[model samples]
Target: MNFSEMKDQVINGVKWYFNRNWNRDDVMNMDEISDEVHSTLKMNTRIIISMLTAYSFGSSVGFIFNYLFKVEQRFVLRLLVGITIGTGNLLYQAITTKDRREIYTGCLKYCVVIVFSIITFFLLETDTTLRMIVIHSVLILFMGYLVIYSQEILYNADFGDIDYVNCTFNVFFHFPGIMIHATRLYLQGEQQEEN
Candidate 1:
């Protein structure tokens, strides 16, 4: 399937998993919310990362690029982007990794982001800007869907944290969303514990 389909599947999958975890009985518990601090870092991080990956197909990057291109050298802009993305991923891994595999995966993901950012800069011609932007816009929303849904699954998933591959994806795309979902999941967990 195409990128849109893949993005939708990812987003929907996360949502579907979360729906199963929403804990209808504890939807409004206050003390139950503190569990956000103890929630699993894997899926919490993954949902954020994938959203950024999907957002590459969205206009946000292009918009940033366009604005930067106007005032800076293209090469400089690209270098900054690569460093920013890589550094962010590295910091995240350093802070959250549990084992060798996590470190390896984190490095691989940063490499991919840097590579893709370069390729995208070269491949996207000026005339086709609008089309790419529209496509990315849709992907951003799709990624958002995945993020919200995935967090839901954190509370309900039998296996859990299936998408912990990319860290930067979430850093750039979800910002506070990952935290919001974490809060919700923890709150639900708290409620369940009370009962």
Candidate 2:
């Protein structure tokens, strides 16, 4: 291929990779709505598990920081905890998945979490325990809403049930442990299909 053709192919590939429909709503029929409902339920369960895992992990880290270390600046410590969790999650995902889309989504989620963590931790002047709780809660809530909203947008985009304007916000935001669960689910589905 010539240089111009190669450049066009690269551009098209990038567009196809990012713009691919995840839920496959275009080819879905009414009979598959039941299956979609089941899948949605499973997704919700995974999301809840993700939220709880992140909350518990953050709490444990905060406890360790509080009792073990005598750091005067608790807020900075809490911020460090968030950074550690986000970075660790992103690194783990990058190591495990060869899928570029998954890695990109993971990075996007990490960035959102870290930005929110910084804002919440620095702006709020609360006690150590309360600050930790508030920050974790905020992050969990934000991620949960983003995932659900994105799912809805993707699912309904075909039928025009949702506003197209909101389609620009499509994202797959996973919390600390969520990517592991998602990967497991993907693998399990592949195995079942193969069987």
Candidate 3:
């Protein structure tokens, strides 16, 4: 085909892919809808409690660091907090689901965190401003991940899949605690500066 014709075909293909609706059913039957509701709510309470426990543990650590240690580098503490909570949540999910693949994935994700921690530990001796910049970048990415993760949960719940509700619960639970801790730190700093 000529170049113009090939370009047209590619554009058409892209449009078709994006426009396609994967859910074949125009409307879910009443029985299927009822099943979806039951499945979505089945273990929601347990998931929420587990998530809160993990988040509280993580945030408690961050709080100590911020208030007691006077760590100005809040993002570093935040990362450690996130890793702790994420690891606990992942293991809990794997245990409850009894899924080997999820277990492996969780391990892999933790390995990344471990590597990051090791690197951060070494870099702590470097220039403070540089280290803060790096930590800030990582924190931004992590926050973005949380936002996307929450959206994924909402989408799955709306679509009646509910497969990753545990993951969603953990993200939602962990983030607010961290944010509150950060806000407290800011307020404390302001008070101290005023003094």
Best by lDDT: 3
Each candidate structure's TM-score, on Cα atoms with residue i matched to residue i, is: 0.29, 0.28, 0.29
Candidate with the larger TM-score of 2 and 3: 3
CA shift of 146, model 3, Å: 2.7
In Å, residue 99's CA in model 1 sits off its true spot by 25
Q: What residue runs in model 1 are displaced by over 4 Å at the alpha carbon?
A: 1-19, 23-33, 42-126, 157-195
Q: Give the C-alpha lDDT of model 2.
A: 0.47
List all candidate RMSDs to the true structure: 13.3, 16.4, 16.7
Misplaced by over 4 Å in model 3 are 12-81, 84-129, 160-195
In model 2, the clashing pairs are none
* Candidate 3 residue lDDT tens string, 1-195: 899999999999765533312121211111222344334533552464366555645654645646643456445455556555554655354335433344345545655665576567667755454554455455445534443343334335456555444564546544554344344555766787799
lDDT string, candidate 2, 1-195, tens digits: 899999999999765544434432322222323344434433443443355445545654645655644334545455556645654564454345434355346646776766665566557654554555555665555554444343443355334344322232223222332334344456767787899
